[model samples]
Target: MILEIIIEEMSKIVSTIPYLVKYKKHRLTLDDLSTLANDSWLNDQVINMYGELIMESADSKVHFLNSFFHKQLMDKGYEGVKRWTKQVDLFSKRLLLVPVHLEVHWCLVTADFLKKTVILYDSQGIGLQKVARNIVKYLLKEAKEKKQSAFEMGWTVSSNEEIPQQTNENDCGVFILEYSRCLALSEPLHFLQKDTPKIRKRIYKELCDRTLHKKG
Candidate 1:
């Protein structure tokens, strides 16, 4: 019974988010919530309790919420839906799982092919600082192993102290080495612009050596 109430309250909170945003004109009324209950795409199951907290918090920043929704929609393959109302409803349902401290935002950068970007803003207050650092390291390691560009892939943590903004120069943190267009076949990796030929060659050689060693 508790779980059921949580789901019901979550649904109401999510359905009302767009209206609560600064840009939205129409206030989410009882009729609006009823409309959401009737939607088929909205997920009724509550998978994560932390996500439910993020969705319900009125003080939650926009960026974190948006990022969570964008990832959820993309993972579910619902990015190409034609109707705005449906998309909004779907977004609300997916956003219920994000932790409240991370300010998430999603934007449709290009309408022609449905290119969406998810931005996450981490306030310096919570325990998110370490999580952000870990994410950066993981992304960098993955890019290096795959021979992908890591330049464009980066994150920013806002805090009171003088935090290191440049990842490449920091020893304790991760650095993104840029790649050249010639090296990147698909969408340019974020760090493609910062890599030199020497660095690329060294990485390639190390990867090849590791592969050969594994096979041997």
Candidate 2:
């Protein structure tokens, strides 16, 4: 997926935000430039808007797991995932588009059911081997109940290297969003850290014009 193509198109597209956030009540002055983004922005902008768009445009079955759903699995175990899985058709959705928020950092994890592999997308360009393993464990337990015996619980996990790396801590969430958007569309990531300003603006415009509702 060409990042430029998506950004360019979003610049011209009119969108709405269905998800809501607390920051909407507060005006963001120039003083807030260096401040980190809140969870509302990350949840709404990255997962709700961008993630939903990726799934809606696809012909193949893609499942967009919300950050809340991820929290449940990460903290509450397989029992928590069981409840979330019941809300969607799991076995049919081969592409599990999960955006994981860990210790104030963001990472994208793709459980390719068909490929039987786990792909971690971190803009920091770091290996989250433990996180990958945790995902596989959850998937293994999940697959059992779903009767997906073909899915290997011990799947190979990998992450990208050429993707942009964030020097600043606040942009990790943004990178996860970009990574998910590109990987969901099967596009090669061409973004870099220097493009942060452009990336932020691109997504800001998208939030203003390309969303369905305000979500947080």
Candidate 3:
């Protein structure tokens, strides 16, 4: 029965047609859907699409930065991505979810305005203090440029070492998605690395249904 169930799920993952889900002006095609397959590294489109779901589920209180946001900010500095938030007031949001893609790995950085924190969530258990610092610096610059004032100083910027970690290379993307979901919903990070297979299916279904699954 277990083997049959696994096969069934794999079939579903393989059978998804192109443009299966479209959210937040981003269209998820077959290529993106396939990334959810067994052990496959997820692409930018899937991450961004799921981010849209997270924002919706958070009642729009969470502002999700696209997968490219960090890359642009780090590559060209804040000026390169200044227009990214032209009409949006990031400080007005309760949380900012920034998905960080470092070459081949995926991680998350969340800016909590209420708590005055910029945290890095990496499944590899690496301390990315520089990434956190850059985000904090960006927030300061953004405040000066948009609000004509300074952002709150002395914000806590550090990596979260206590969170669940991945045992394999390919699951980092999935781990990032789960971490983002838990944080956005204000839920405890009770999930484990073993739960990733189930989590991946949940994410795929959520994408197909255009809604985030709320656990009761």
Candidate 4:
């Protein structure tokens, strides 16, 4: 399933960006789509650190949870995410980019206030309707906790299949990081698998130079 998605995205990239085929031929040729294996943050420390840094700089309200926060929320339910949101003005938060780990792979779900929607971004091609529903449920629970009976799940819930994909197993972590980066800035899903190498370097440069919010 993941390989099929990667191939699909690769074909699109080749057609859209012809020069990428010359810069890195290996990107269009890797084929390691075996059994889906779960990766750890320890092995993927750089990816997690980039994700955490972006999440930390996102807002003072702590609207989104990333990396280890997934386990906390999955274990403790909506109250887990709410614990952080309560520290600041929850209603004032414009967006929340929660990195959700589904089984072995990683994906992202955004609680977008500007669009009044919950958008799912999965690079593996699997739609995350159920995951988006859970976030909506969490929002309702959060509203109720604040003594607001008017909260509802009427916000839009959808998935974006157009983002980048990994040609192999290990790159899912990188895809999650890129997903958070793009969505946090409210940008369109313009990145592709070919951008992964550059993104990995960009993370280090951004951290070193302290220039994450803008393109250089």
Give lDDT tens digits, candidate 4, residues 141-173. 777787655455457889877777777666676
- Model 1 worst lDDT window (10 residues): 105-114
Ranking by lDDT: 3, 2, 4, 1
What is the overall TM-score of model 2 with all chains considered together? 0.72
Q: Write the per-residue lDDT of candidate 3 for residues 83-112, one digit (tens) a residue.
A: 998878888889999989888899899999
lDDT scores of the candidates, listed in order: 0.25, 0.63, 0.85, 0.61
lDDT of 2 by residue, 1-216 (tens): 223444455456455632222232322222222122331234433445556655765554777777676778777888977877686766677688788877677888888877788888776666776777778888878778778887635578887566678777677777877776666667667777677666665665454444432222
Listed in order, each prediction's TM-score against the native is 0.21, 0.72, 0.89, 0.68
Global CA lDDT of candidate 1, please?
0.25
Error of 1 at 175 (Å): 31
On residues 1-216, what C-alpha lDDT tens digit does candidate 1 reach at each position? Answer: 323433555565666354321112213323322212211111111112112222233232211122233344334433331232232322222111122212221111100001112222222222334433433343344334445563225434332222212222111101111111111112233332133223333322222222111111
Best candidate, TM-score-wise? Answer: 3
Give the higher-lDDT candidate: 2 or 4.
2
Collision pairs in model 3: none
- Span of ten consecutive residues with least summed lDDT in model 3: 1-10
Q: Highest lDDT: which candidate?
A: 3
* Candidate 4 residue pairs in backbone clash: none
